[model samples]
Target: MENIVIIGNGIAGVSAARHIRKLSDKRIIIISAETDYFFSRTALMYVYMGHMKFEHIQPYENWFWEKNRIDLVRGYVTQVNHTEKKLLVDNSRTVAYDKLIIATGSKPNKFGWPGQDLHGVQGLYSKQDLDLLEVHAPNKEVCKRAVIVGGGLIGIELAEMLRSRDIPVTFLVREKSFWDGVLPQGESQMINEHILEHHIDLKLETNLVEIIADENGRAKAVTTDKGETIACNLVGLTAGVSPNIDFLKDSGIALGRGVKVNRFLETNIEDIYAIGDCAEQHEAIGSRRPIEAVWYTGRMMGETVAQTICGNKLEYKPGHWFNSAKFLDIEYQTYGWVFTARSKKESEAHFHWRHPQEKVCVTIAYHNETRQFLGINTFGIRMRHEIFDRWLTESRSVDHVMEFLKDANFDPEFYENYEKDIISKFNSDMGTTLAVKNKSWKRIFKTA
Candidate 1:
């Protein structure tokens, strides 16, 4: 029996292990210092907001691992000896393996600011971070105020978590607008206003200079780049994250911004592979980044890598970009290529429509010359992912997509349809009266 060792218990590692077990009878061992079992990392915010407990985030029951014959080790990996095919654990134990998988995922980025190592100063990434938050900011009385240092998704999530407990939050975003670098101007402005409406002290164009520490080495306040000092009990450093591959520094594995791997997720060394956020491709895949920290991509990578380990080599090809996120209470989803103001290099045209009374809007991007559909970003509305994905794959024209926009909607039957309004706005903007066409259910459901 071949012993397969995986270095992380995240979704990538667990997915690989499960798929490998189904294909082969190999013995698998997953090791992690973060937690004993795999749990949903994205659900950490919900846990803090009292929506669900820690155990609820775990998809599998405790007995599932034992029944599947997968071994779980709760220890830190200090080093990996590629030549000997062994891992050195913190307890000085040596674990030998025939094949090794590195899916260590990401860690919070720190820029070596002054007093950033204080007790109350932390980043929200791991379960340990949540535990520390529970200790530092148990309630509104305990945590008088929290100053967040970044304007990214994690920063806003931490702000929402703090707000759920009636704790005051001061958000410091270096960007002039909230996430403008990634979102369109209209959407970014709307989100900025929405965040402000939530009573958060959103300080735009601000940067953190240093974290002030009290006598006991706890964070007391934060100093900004403008020389303004804001007193606070906790400081959140949600700047960003980097691949967690420090243990592989001396392990003879090639690394770029992350562990360098081919499309097959294979490392330079034979019998060793990497997946998830820790795996960096030689080039970007379509519009997807080289290092995608998204959960579904990680899961897909795991499934792809498992086939190769089981004797059926497969390449990782994640087609058609799709992602969903929430800004405060509003739900946002985007499929295909919706470029930001900074990244809009091509000759494209945008048609944007928003509800007069609600925070709902949709922006469609398409090539100006060819009229080929590029992407769509919808907020406060539900759209079928498979429909847009198929349309993008087929290279549907903007006019064709708009003519049948009502078919892609995933809202309830009683919910109002905005297809007519969206079509009207598009026609009014483009100076073309393209009437909506009715199609049978078979035609609408047909694959492109």
Candidate 2:
């Protein structure tokens, strides 16, 4: 039997192992130094916020791996020798493999800032980071103030986690508006207001110059580009993450920003493939970034690579784009193409609607010339992914989408519907009064 070894027991590596096990009886082993068992990385914030325990984030029971004939190794792979088909574990042990998969995932980015390696300065990416957070910022007394230096998803998550324990958080965002690089002006402005509403010191257009350390070598304060210094005990460097492939620097594998892989997830070295956050496609795929750190894309790459490893080669094809995240009190969801102001190259028209008394709004993007629906961004509202996916696939027009918007709504029946109001606004803005067709009770109540 061929021996298969997968490094990094994240969603990608675990998914590949499980799929391969279903297809073949090959000996499979997953190696990781992060944790003994694979846990949901996204749910780490919930664990800190008292919403869930550490064990609750794990997808499978403790004995699931042993019962399923999948072996687990708790070690770190320091280097890979492609010619020998062996991996050096902790520079001591050698693990040979008939085939190998590299899914080491991502690590928090550090830009060589002064005092960046301080004890209380950390990034929220791995289990070890969470453990460090517990030590440094267990409560308000321990953590006087937390200064998060970014406005991305992870940055906000860290701010929320600290705030959950009544810890003061001073959020520093480089962008003029909150997440303006990704979200539209209206949506981004709404989030900016919402963040301030939560009593967070939301600092916009602020850049961290350096972190000042205390006598104990922990974070003491942060100096900004504007020469402003904020005193804080915890400094969260949640700027972004890069592919965790530092160990592979001398491993003879081709690497760009991440490990270079073909569409089939095969690397330059034969029989040794890469996937997930560590795998970068030789060419960009549509609008997808070269390094997509999203969890679902990692799982997709895992499943795709497994087929090829199982003698059923298949190209990785991550279909339509869709993602959701929470911003303070608002829940946001977006599907298809919804570029920010900076990236709005093509001529597009936007129809935006905001509720009078609620932090709810939806923005519809459409082609200015063709009037074809491009995408929709909804905040404080739940929309079915499948519905937008189908609409985007069918190339539905903006008018058609608005007219039948109620049909795609996934909110509870008792929840107030905003379709009529949205349609009225759209018609009023476009100088036309288009009536929406009445839907049967069955269609209206149908699940997405």
Candidate 3:
């Protein structure tokens, strides 16, 4: 039997293992220092907010692994001796394999601010980080205040997590407006208002100068770029994350911002592959980034690589960019390409719509000349992925999309239908008399 070893049993590694098992009977061993079993990484915040338990994040029962003939090892991988096809785990134990897969994910980025290594200063990424959060900020009394650095999605999430426990939070954003680089002016402004409404002290155009450490080496406060100090017990470093590929430094594997991989996710060495957040595409795939940190893309890469290992070689092709996230009470979804002013093409234009009082809005991007629909960003609304995906593939026009807007709505019955309002706004902007049409259930449900 061929011994297949996979390091870092995240969604990518487990996905490849599961698919590979279905295709061939190979000895599969998944090693990770994080946990004994695979768990949902996205649900870590929910676990902290009392919505779920640590064990509940795990999707599979303990018996499932044994039944599937997949072996799990609990140890930190210290080194990868690729020449010998062996891994140094815990700096002592050695494991050998015929084929190896590296699915190690990402680690939070810290830029060496003073007192960043203090007890109360940390980043939320792994289960260990979640555990640390519980110790540092269990409640309002324990952690009086938390100062979050960076203006990205992770920063917002940390603010929400701290607020759930009645802990006051002061958010420090270097950007003039929160996520302005990615979002439009309207959406970013709306988010700024929504955040303030939640009672978070959002400080824009502010930078963390230093984190003041207490006598116990815990973070007590942080000084800003303007030389203003704010007292806080916890400091969350939500700057960003980079690929976790430190162990492979001496392994002769080519490295960019992440592990360099070809279309098939193969690394520089033979019989070795890398996937998930740690794998960087040799070339950009369409509008997608080389190293994607998103969960769905990681899952897709795993399934694609599994085929090659099982004698059915397949290329990793993640079509049509789509993602969903929650910004406090509002749910946001985006499909296809929605570029900001910096990245937008000269021929591209956008039509935006928002409710008078509610936090409901949508931005549609299209070709200015051709009127072909390019992408859309919807907030406080549910949309059908299949509908938009099919429209993109068909190269449907913006006018056509507006006429059939109701079909794209996921919950036309329960959710407040905004089709008429959206159509009216679009017509007002485009100067075209387009009427809203009833949803075609057949068209919405049809699969390619």
Candidate 4:
């Protein structure tokens, strides 16, 4: 049996272990600094709102590993010796492996400004961070206000959680709008409006100068770049995170913004693999550059590594990037060249606009040259938006979808034809299966 060791018990590590176990009777050992089994890191925000218990957010029970006969070692990984294939745990102990997997994840990026280490300043990352917030969980009498220092996904989620608990929240954004890097200026404005309408104060184009700590060593206020100061009890920083690569400094492995890997998910060192937040992956569309830090990407990489180890003939080829999130009763999404839509070519550059209400709007765009559905943004839509599924498979020119909408009529047959072409294209290109279930095409199709 092969001796295999995996560091970190996150989604990537767990998925790798599960998939690899099915391929061979390897002596698989998983080492985790934390004790919890696989759990939904994405669901941490719900815990703050008291909508879910910690137990409810857990993805798997203890029995999951016992059934697989995989060895679980609970210890902090302090160091790594790639040449010797050994890992140091808890200062004195070491474990050797024939194959090593590093899925250690990432640590929250500190603002690097002065007074960041103050008692009342926090970064929302792990369950530990959530636990700390729970201890100081907002109350009108105790903790009335909080300053969320970033306006991205985690920051937005935390703002909602704080509001649900009746805690007044203010968001400080470095860009001109919320999610500036993720969405277009117009889409960002729409979200910013919705955020403001919900009673959340937003400070745009602002930078954090320093956190002001009170005499008791707790954050009492925060100073911004514009020389404005706001009194607050808690300060949450969701700036971003860096890969957990301190242990690998002496390991002779290559490094980039994250651990470097090729199409096979194998690192520079022999018999060693990296995945999840710690490992960067090739993007599905356009440049195919490495993308770090997303739950779905981590899970996909984990499975791909396992298949490679199992001698399965498969190569990981990411396609049709999908991005979606729901916030404050509004669904928002952006995918593909939504970021790259500034090029010259108005007609060739696909962009459509729709305003459902005064404060609600929809924007969809595509890269006609690539026949790639670029992105869609919808605000205040009553129904769920699953345009991502269509965007993933559809090859229709963005103009077609736009033209269909201009007729002010619902032609299920046209949509059905478009969907069929997309399914066929995906199947031919990626060897993906796309069978309609239970003859369900009738439901979405218009019979002539």
- Each prediction's Cα RMSD? 1.5, 1.9, 1.3, 7.0
Candidate 1: the clashing residue pairs are none
Clashing pairs in 3: none
- Sliding window of 10 residues with minimal summed lDDT for model 2: 439-448
Task: Rank candidates, TM-score, best first.
Answer: 3, 1, 2, 4
For each candidate, give its TM-score against the true structure.
Answer: 0.97, 0.96, 0.98, 0.84
Model 1 lDDT, full chain set: 0.90
Per-residue CA lDDT of model 3 for 1-448, tens digit only, reads 9989999889999999999999989999999999899999988999999999989999999899999999999999999988999999999999999989999999999898988899999998899999999999999999999999998888898899999999999999998888888887788888999999999999999999999988888899999998899999999999889999989898998999999999999999999999999999997788788988999988998899999999999999999999998888889999988887777999999999998899999999999999999999999988899889989999999998877777788777644467778888899999999986666656656644
The per-residue C-alpha lDDT of model 3 at residue 149 equals 97
Q: Assess the local accuracy of residue 100 in candidate 2 as a C-alpha lDDT between 0 and 100.
A: 97
Question: Best candidate, TM-score-wise?
Answer: 3
Write the number of the candidate with greater TM-score, choosing between 3 and 4.
Answer: 3
RMSD of 3: 1.3
Model 1 residue 409 CA deviation in Å? 0.9
Candidate 2 or 1, higher lDDT: 1
Local distance difference test, per candidate? 0.90, 0.89, 0.91, 0.73
For candidate 2, the clash count comes to: 0
Off by over 4 Å in 3: 414-416, 444-448
